[model samples]
Target chain A: MRNLLKILYTYHFLLMFIALEVISIIMLVQNNRYHSASYAVKAKAVSGSIYSTVSDFKEYLSLKEANKALAHENAILRNYLKSNYGTFDTTKISVNDSIYKQHYRFQDAKVVNNTVNKQYNYITLNKGTKHGIKPDMAVIGPQGIVGLINGVSENFSNVLPLLNVDFRVSARLKKNNYLGSVTWEGKDFEYCTLKDIPQHVQVNKGDTVITTGYTGSFPEGIMIGTVSSSKLKDGNFLSIEVKISTVFKTLSYVSVIEDLTKEEVTKLKTETEK
Target chain B: MIGEYIKIALRFFFLVVLQLLVLNNVQWSGYLNPYLYVLFILLLPFETPNWLLIILSFLLGFTIDSFSNTWGMHSAACVLTGFIRPYFLKIISPRDGYDSATRPIIRDFGLEWVIKYSLILIFIHHFALFYIEVFKFSLFFHTFLRVVLSTLFTFTLVIISHFIIYKR
Candidate 1:
């Protein structure tokens, strides 16, 4: 017993090191699972509130730029307002008013904390569960699609932005409607790679890419990026590169899109698969 | 001794806030994310207990992770650095060894020794961090570029901060 204790004492530092490393690795594995580490994310109470306060001050510094973006979005929205589409002639073929239901809602939120340089980037917003924010809601900037909500707490929410390696968006060519997935290479914030595109599709430089509603997360036609380069790789696929539209560095204001029919659609799809 | 401990504690808070608020937002070219908070771990007293060093490094990294939303990546890399630090010191120890009160700062250790020591630790830390972050050997070359560039960037910051905080 005395000799065993002596051995343990001599190697205690190494043991401690291994123990700490194991704990950290366990946390890392837990965090990589989407639902498991949701509560431990930055959107929790004290840390979330503190980051919100700090980012609030930083947000004020860019109020001018944010205001301009907001005005531009408002102008674009005004052009598509139901009122601007002109009154439909209801007298002919008395249409059922209840047949048309809104399936998407937008809520405004301020970015409280953001990081683009990390391999797994996450954005923290000033709105959360208390403000009706929820996980899986699609987040969009004024100019383009931003990210998907990962977790939400009382007053803050975390977004897995496109700059992250783990983030992927289903996108389609604006001109040809060819479907592909856009993923970051963890190298550049402004660029992401579009994969699974067949080489037969004549993809051109400067072609636009937009989100496809097939994922049910984002509305179809929301701008994603522009094809910067496309080259044939392995003779079977076109290794396409895209220049992401949203300026992530200056990103401040965003709107969380709540898909009202998501639950229904998901349920129906699962049942159909079964 | 108490005064030195208190000072380290204050520096810890300051470094965390600076990293979370200022450096986190500063991105020039996407690959140049200078992690200045690691300086806190590097600046710990020469004779700090191995257990205490590991704990302190973990706490510092965990705090940064909380703000950055990278739960365990930073802490894991930090613990690795702390675990290797004693061996690192043993390998590079001076002929007479070190004093408990002296730090690894440039002013006391001379520019050459400090640079060698800082580069070694910074390279190890950044390599561990970037590789674990990507977690894929397929992009080994890409991750290597990040490690190299970030090491240089962070090392530059470490040198500049040494001059700023410890000028005669």
Candidate 2:
């Protein structure tokens, strides 16, 4: 027993190294699962505040660009207003119309921190649980879809952006409605891969791709990207390259979408699975 | 002795800030990520206790991970670098051994010695970091390419930083 103690004393430095490495590996594995709430909450709060401060300074440099984008969005929204069109019929629709129940609500948030080069990139937003942001909600930029909220704290949240290799979303070609899955290849921030579409489908360059809404995370028909190119893969499916619509580097303001019927859908799905 | 400790503490804070605020935002390409934070571990006093070195490296890495959301990749790499530092120092020591009063900086050690010392440790750190990041061997070649490119980039930045920080 004394000899064993001597051995341990001699190799204490190596033992300590191994112990620390083991702890780090455990944290890494746990972090990949994307469900470590305590760490996420604490880390997000600290990093989020620092990033928000830096972003506050950066906000000035990009004010002109942000104003331009907001102005464009305002113009598009104005065209959808009720006052834009003259009423031809006298019949008035009731406020609680059965055909038009609200299915989704959007909350505006500014991006405080973002990274596009990593294999599992995450974006931090200024709004969080206080603003009703929750896990699994869809985040969309002005140009197109952004990502999904994977972690949330009191006043900040983390987004698993489209650039992450682990991020997958259901997308369909607008021309033929052919469905496929969109995934990042961990190479270019501007491009992602769309798979599972059969080679027989007619795929043309610049064909629009949008969300399928089959998962209920995103509403149907939200723009994802446009097909850049397509190639035959394994003689069965076509591996198509998509140019993502939202330029993540310049991404500033985004809207987090909350689906009101999501709980019901999830309940039904769980029951059906059983 | 207390002044030396204070200097080390100030350097730790300074390097972390430089890494998070400036270097982290500078994404030249998908392949080049210059992690200058490891310089903190590289510049520690030669006589720093082995256990303390490991712990400090782990803390530095964890702090960066918390901000970047990399979890433990940086921590693991930093710990390994710290573990191997003493051995590397022994291998590349001067004829009369290191002066007790001197720290591991380019001004104290010649340019070639400093470069050689940092090259091996930085390569190991970047290799472990990028590989642990992907956490798979399927992209072995791709990750290796990234490690090599990033190591070169980081080495250049570290050398430039030495001249800037330890100006003659």
The candidate scoring highest on TM-score is: 2
Compared with the true structure, model 2 gives a TM-score of: 0.94
Candidate 2 lDDT, A1-274, residue by residue in tens: 9999999999999999999999999988888654454567787898889999999998999999999999999999999997998864534555336548889999999999998878889899999888888899999999999999888999999888898887889999998888899998887899999999999999999999999997437999999898899999989999999999998988999999999999999899899999
Q: Write the per-residue lDDT of candidate 2 for residues B54-128, one digit (tens) a residue.
A: 999999998898878888889999999988998888999999998898978888987998999989999999998
Mind listing the fnat for each candidate?
0.62, 0.76
What tens digits encode model 1's per-residue C-alpha lDDT throughout A1-274?
A: 9999999899988988888888878777778654444756533667778777788788789989988988998999899887786667876326645546787899999887787877788887889888898888899999898999888887888888888877888999999888889888887789999988998999888999999987537988989889999888888988899999999988998999999899999899899999
TM-score of each: 0.92, 0.94
RMSD of each: 2.3, 2.2
Candidate 2 CAPRI level: medium
Candidate 1 wrongly placed segments (more than 4 Å): A41-43, A82-87, A90-100
lDDT of 1: 0.85
State chain A's TM-score for model 1. Answer: 0.91
